[model samples]
Target: MSTFTKPNHIGRKISRIRELRNMKQEALAQALGTNQQAVSILENSETIDEDKLIAIAKVLGVTVEAIKSFSEEGMINYFNTFNESDNNFNHYNTCTFNPLDKLVESFEENKKLYERLLKAEQDKIEYLEKLLKGK
Candidate 1:
């Protein structure tokens, strides 16, 4: 047997997600183009408008569903799962360039810049010598 139930305290869920993202109510209010007091009132309410919820979720860098289904224990469990080495997987990890190649590229760029500056200084010295000889 299975049961269907609706989640409660949607506003509190939004608040929890915001806090987890290291955001303050005032910051969220700024993102929403409202004010801190409005944010406080929103956090204290039971329900939030759908459009505003979407806006808040975007500002918090999360999906609306994430805020809707958020719970403290669930978040902790999710983080713990990542801490276990066995669960670590490189499913989508890709590197555009090898680290050694990147280092070589950076060194080459710096070498080119140094060469250009050295040539400039040499040219300036030659120009000054020519001016003194003419005088």
Candidate 2:
């Protein structure tokens, strides 16, 4: 039997991570300064350049290692194992890190990104204003 089997395929891993993050391919493409068709091709690729992979990981809000080691089956298994009786759900799903802590951390990261985007836009406006003054 000859068949291709690559559980750690980075392209597929990126696609899954994007989906889990509730991001569309167009959004990912925009973040990468590319297009939806390019993103589609990327997902179909078996191998990707390291620098590009790092860029994708950044846009996906994950580490390069996280994308490299990602597995669809593993994620399914993790969620499957998380279901428990209603009374014991919280007890059974006790995590090494608090969920609230993760939420707060995500909020902080989003705030930082928002601030950076605002600053960039403000800088662009200032530059345009200077140009107008010159003209």
Candidate 3:
């Protein structure tokens, strides 16, 4: 016998994935062309029909196998990873530096340069007015 444990509660797994996706029973029911009461009954059961499971998976934007193997630990890990990213906006897995941060920095520098150029123009206009008055 294998020591690995598998999640077998298909209905509860579907419910959990739906909840994680921020979906309500009524919304899921609407997508599945069923009523909320029927969805409730399905979620409360241990097994679900394969056809219904396929429909539910499509509605939930997940695979049928994912629904069958969904676990609380996996959900928790996903949230933890998401929260870590939420806490640090600069952290992106694809690159060592955030391009958005660089863009914002470049924008600030350009803003300062534009302000300086505008001030210089104003100073030139003031000097021209002063010279005109003295002439």
Give me the candidate number with maximum TM-score. 1
lDDT of 1 by residue, 13-128 (tens): 98888888899999999999999999999999898989999999899998989888888889899888887754346544666679999999999999999999999999999999
List, residue by residue over 1-135, the lDDT tens digit for candidate 3.
779875488878888888889999999999888899999999988888899888999999999888887889987898799777874766444587899999999999999999999999999999999999999
Could you tell which candidate, 1 or 2, scores higher by TM-score? 1
What range of 10 consecutive residues in model 1 has the weakest lDDT sum?
85-94
Q: TM-score of every model?
A: 0.58, 0.57, 0.56
lDDT measured at residue 62 in model 2 versus the true structure, 0 to 100: 89
- For each candidate, what is the lDDT? 0.89, 0.90, 0.88
TM-score of 1: 0.58
lDDT of 2 by residue, 21-91 (tens): 99999999999999999999999888899999999999998899889888878888888775745558677
Task: Please report how far candidate 3 places residue 96 from its true position, in Å.
Answer: 12
Instruction: Candidate 3: list runs displaced more than 4 Å.
Output: 1-7, 81-135
Steric overlap count per candidate:
0, 0, 0
**How well does candidate 3 score on lDDT at residue 59?**
92
Clashing pairs in 2: none
How high is the lDDT of residue 51 in model 3? 90
In model 1, residue pairs whose N, Cα or C atoms come closer than 3 Å (at least 3 residues apart or on different chains), thus clashing, are none
- Which is the better candidate, 1 or 3, if ranked by TM-score? 1
Q: Whose lDDT is greatest here?
A: 2
